[model samples]
Target: MNTNDLKIFEAVVESGSFTKAADIMFTVQSNVTARIKSLEEEFNAKLFSRTSRKVELTEEGKILMNYAKQIQHLVEEAKNEIISNETVNGHLTIGCMETTMTLKAPEILLAFGEKYPAVELEFKSDNRDSLISAVLNYKLDAAFVSGPLNISGLEKIKIKEEQLVILASSKEAGLNKLLAKEPMKSIVFDNGCIFRERLESWFSHKGIHNYKSIELNSIEGIINFVDAGLGISLLPEEVVSRYYQGRNICTYSLNKQLGTMTTLLVYRKGKAPSTALQSFIDMHIEDIA
Candidate 1:
């Protein structure tokens, strides 16, 4: 009947079980069950069908879920609008790709934090796909991505263009030439990484599809793995240049045919940017341009 009920419903759907949702929401399982029951009663329809295995959404629940999403979005917008007028003070959640978190983002964030110390900044670093989803779900105010992005319902502002390079340990000489000898082994972030996806697509396009992947979750892990001669990876030139100096990594530019992926500052369309967030983005735009 209220925002809390909508949040409970959304959490339950995402977590896939009432008990799990309760744990996430920091409430008892019965409380989660009661909230869902209250919501279903309010709609005069069943929202979920529970089985021994898992909970599934009923057809009516599907419809309500969509409405609930809109309701939650509007409520948050209202709250932000009210709080934004008081001062440029509130929580700002940003989604970042691992590469950006290393160097470029820090300078901009440092300046922003100093300028608006009242604004609390929270960052979530993950793969590109999840960042896009976070923006779509209103979980992040904005995100920085390496692209050409395929995200819908968002505005993509070109921040800068970064060259993508194939990198290996400095000790491995002539490995770039050896890429043709066999499908290269790669140390990759997960499937959601834009660079990882781009590299795979490039390989598939060139009829080189037999590479092996070592999956890791962080940029530090990738750099360390590549430093140990585990495999090669593709990253923005700026990111690697700042972080990999004297770290036993050698880099070579990808072919000109692959071009460069422009780095973008992305946010959902039709939403107003807060003063602090706008100022931060404007600073980046000014500094870059």
Candidate 2:
């Protein structure tokens, strides 16, 4: 029930280790354990299932974790909002898609941090769906995500519009000829990926059905697999060109209807951003998380 207990709980959940969470808080492991025990006693529910390797959340723990995260974020938001605008402070947690994190977020973080030196910033990166879910649940103050976002109760500010491109190996035939040769196999992220739906739509449009798809978690893996002639994938032109530079990969532009995606800075619709978060949006640099 206490904010401090929830904060400690959040740290433990994030670290997955009482000792490490204690280290982060500059406290002893026993103190961390005591705080967790206090929380469990106060709520009359077990929060974590402990094992030798790591602590896992129980069903009740998972439910409480959501509320704990939302409370922790709100506490931070309130602290930041109550501070003088002339001097911004408090922690800001933002979510971002992997593409934006890699290609755009660095400069934005640097500039924002320089402007509000007292503010602490933490970023979590994942697929668009995950980012959206985190933001919706108040796990993040805001996030940089790609569309199409159909979720409710979100306000989006379009930051970047990227054209999706298909990368083809230089040794292989062009897109048409390549598709003709085999049932398409793509190296992509799992179902919640930003580009998965678009990529599937593109295939369906081309009358290519029942193709083989493989999931990969790394940007390098996706690009390398395609470059090695494993399969084709749809990705942001700007990102692929930047990361896969000096390679023998050639980009094939898709139809405008299928190839364009927009990166958005989305937050809850009714809530106002903290000064620290506002600075990030106002900086409005061309790219990054």
Candidate 3:
């Protein structure tokens, strides 16, 4: 019905829950529901299929999402062009892998905020695939993802490379005991994580299949699980050093190709960069190298 309605609709579909949409949009859940209802009434069509646990867009909603995104983009571009941002003033949503958030991102995040205090920066912590998907959907201005990323529809600038390391508990038995342990559990992030893929490949290449995986949603939990002798995990050496320095952990180096991975700052290739995003990339992308 209106721009605000479209914005709310887009947020709901993207967030997939009224509660999350309300938080992202900075409003109440009832208000989000009301606005969406108003939109559906105005358009005389149901936009979302709502259930107890999930909110998904109906077919009509999908078509409207494309238009809503375009409208939002144009509105954002217009605002950026019309405003004089001699000191950049806009919102930038950046998605990142949780691992990068813990180790590599703090200094850059702090510096960026201090330098451009007026720009509103929101950071989302997610796994690699979700981060890339968010960027493609225009939910984020950019994302920090680990690579040898060869994904289409993205432009990636390598910022840093770190060696992936195998971690085991210092007090726990080494390989022999590890291999013989009843359920050789792998501590890992949820399925879409690249590091998990690497760990799986490493096991298969070594003819060690049938290992059970303990899927965790956060890096700290995974590290703690591994450190407590529950299972082993794969993580970047930089991350392990930064967080577990001087802790009771043993690190094993991997083969070159399997060990090294690049951290890339990526954005949608054909999408026009807004002033906020462009300034961000120019400041960090070039500054890093």
Stretches > 4 Å off in candidate 3:
8-61
Q: What is candidate 3's lDDT per residue for 1-289, written digit by digit as tens? A: 6788887887898789999989989999999999999988887889999899998889998888977886887698678667844767788888888887777567767888998787888888898888898887777889999877887889988887889998888888786678677668899988888889999888887778779999998888888888888888999988778778876788888898889888889988876687778888888766876
Best by lDDT: 3
Clashing pairs in 1: none
Best-to-worst order by lDDT is: 3, 2, 1
- After best superposition, candidate 2 residue 264: deviation in angstroms? 1.0
Model 1 stretches with alpha carbons more than 4 Å out: 20-31, 180-183, 202-207, 257-259, 274-276
Which candidate, 1 or 3, would have the higher lDDT against the true structure? 3
The lDDT of model 3 is 0.84
Against the hidden true structure, what lDDT does model 2 obtain? 0.82
- Tell me how far the alpha carbon of residue 21 in candidate 3 is from the true structure, in angstroms, after superposition: 10
Q: What is the per-residue lDDT of model 1 for residues 1-289, given as tens digits with 9 covering 90 to 100?
A: 8799889998899888999999989999999999999998999999999998789899999888877876786676567668778667766788888887876667767888898887878887888788888887777888987777765688877888778887788878676454674657888888878888877877787678788999998888988999998788888777677766879998887776564878788987766666666766787788778
Please give the lDDT score at residue 207 for candidate 3: 78
In candidate 2, which residue pairs get closer than 3 Å at backbone N, Cα or C atoms, i.e. clash?
104-288, 105-288, 105-289
